[model samples]
Target: DTAVSQTPKYLVTQMGNDKSIKCEQNLGHDTMYWYKQDSKKFLKIMFSYNNKELIINETVPNRFSPKSPDKAHLNLHINSLELGDSAVYFCASSLVRGGNNEQFFGPGTRLTVL
Candidate 1:
């Protein structure tokens, strides 16, 4: 069983389409997050939800949105996807609270815009 899993390991699409990436965690964690890693390998925290409540929302574009149906699932949805939005999206989960907490990441979903 996977600790965290994301569907469609790779995605290739046109410049202006709507797409979604699904994520689920089986570790029974209370906090889940979404991160984007660009081609330069710069990782940025996109959004974080703790117990279905949003805890962090970085300076990401409005086109990018995150939804959490429960404590174990968080999904990323993008509208009017652009070439610049092409990046590796990762889903992570943590146990919530404390500085020493470690985030476990999914295999990542690579998005490519043509």
Candidate 2:
């Protein structure tokens, strides 16, 4: 019974290619997020969806898009993959109960651009 899971834990592709990663959470949370972790281990939130409403970080590039079909699923799509995009992407979900929010993170998807 995995609470949160992501497909294709390892992705290796060319720099110009496009890819999509799927994520699903069984925690019945209304809020889901996409995070990118660089080689330096810095985690940055790219997009967050709460009840199907989107909130994207301003610093995130336009190439990265997050789509949520429903409350339990959030998917990430990356266009024009770059070498700098070679990092780990994490899917997280948390129950927004007034302010006591503790996120559950999915197994990361490591994308390597060659």
Candidate 3:
């Protein structure tokens, strides 16, 4: 079984449409995160939840929100989708909040805004 899993691996939609991506980790990690990888292959942390508490990176837009139903799951909801928001979104989990620990990543959900 996959330690981390995400729903709807591929998504293609209109620019203004809203979208939601769900993530779950079976690793029993205390922290989970959502990351965005742009066309240039640069990865950036969008949001993170530690024990179900949210910790977001300042650069992320307000249109993107992360909800942790539990420590094992973190879902992303995007409102007013934009072309710039198109990217591969990854879900990850770690034993602790920061440093040294290896993070397990999901296969990623590719969002394409037409």
Candidate 4:
């Protein structure tokens, strides 16, 4: 069974479009995170939610937000998408225990803004 999963393995949209990526985890982890990998392969944390509460909010644009309806799901919503928003978005989940946060990453959603 896949621990973490994300929808729309690839997404292509024009600028100024709004889109969303759905993520789900079956590992029963209480903490989940969203990351963005740019063309340079630099990974940056976009947001992190613990127990369905927003914990780490990175310095991303206001247009990006992580919506967690429950502990098992955290979806990313992007509004007024720009060219800079094009990147591979990854969803991860981890069980935080005793400072051990071995995150399980999803296949990733490659978003291409045209």
Candidate 5:
């Protein structure tokens, strides 16, 4: 019954490893997105999907990929994880359009690479 949820709230690993974070939403929204917030608190959009179709793809590293099984879920998979990749990954969802539409975020999945 969670609006948005992510697993592995805290992940710590060495460099050059592979990891994944899962996300799900039950808000019945048509669009979902993934955002990365660094230590500086700058939130940047990584990817946005609408009905499993990619709508927005930001300038992100190839090591990161997003997968959407449906309108209510978006997961992130990272390969060759680097220390620079260590950040808080947040899953969000929103309506497709409208001025008042705001993204709802999950608690976040913190990935730490040594």
Candidate 6:
């Protein structure tokens, strides 16, 4: 079974459109994060949650939003998509116990804005 999974592995849309990516983790983790990998392969954390509570929110554009309905699910919604928004978005979860920071990442959703 996949530890973490994301829906719609590939998403292609035009600029100004809105889209969402769903993510779920079966690892019983308390912390989760939304990461964006740019073309240069630089991974940056967009949002972080612990037990469904917003913890760390990076300085990403306001158009990017992270919603956590529960402890096991965290979804990302993007409004007014732009060409610069194209990247591989990854959902990750971790059992933040005793400072153990091993994160399990989903397969990733590649979003391309034309």
Alpha-carbon lDDT, every model:
0.92, 0.94, 0.92, 0.93, 0.87, 0.92
* Model 3 lDDT, residue 38, Cα: 99
Clash count, one per candidate: 0, 0, 0, 0, 0, 0
lDDT string for model 2 (1-114, tens) is 999999989999999999999999998888999999999999999999998689999999999999888899999999999999999999999999564689999999999999
Candidate topping lDDT:
2
lDDT of 5 at 6: 94
Which ranges in model 3 have alpha carbons more than 4 Å from their true place? 97-100
**By TM-score, who's the top model here?**
2
Model 2 off-target regions past 4 Å?
none
| Candidate 6 residue runs with Cα over 4 Å from true position | none
Tens digit per residue, CA lDDT, model 6, 1-114: 999999989999999999999999998998999999999999999898886578655579889888988999999999999999999999999999764899999999999999
Which runs in model 1 stand beyond 4 Å of their true positions? 97-99
**Residue 9, model 1: Cα distance from true site in angstroms:** 0.3
Specify the poorest-scoring 10-residue window by lDDT in model 5. Answer: 50-59
State the lDDT of candidate 1 residue by residue for 1-114, as single tens digits.
999999989999998899999999999888999999999999999998887688666589899889988888999999999999999999999996663569999999999999
Tens-digit lDDT string for candidate 5 (4-114): 999989999999998999999998888888999999999999998886578555579888888887777888999999889989999998986653568899999988899
Alpha carbon lDDT at 10, candidate 3: 96
Residue-wise lDDT of candidate 4 within 21-96, one digit each (tens)? 9999998888999999999999999899997578665479889988999989999999999999999999999998
Q: What RMSD, rounded to one decimal, does every model reach? A: 1.5, 1.0, 1.6, 1.2, 1.6, 1.3
**1-114 per-residue lDDT for model 3 (tens digits):** 999999989999998898999999998889999999999999999987887578889999899999888888999999999999989999999987455678999999999999
Per-candidate TM equals: 0.94, 0.96, 0.94, 0.95, 0.92, 0.94
> Compared to the true structure, candidate 4 yields what TM-score?
0.95
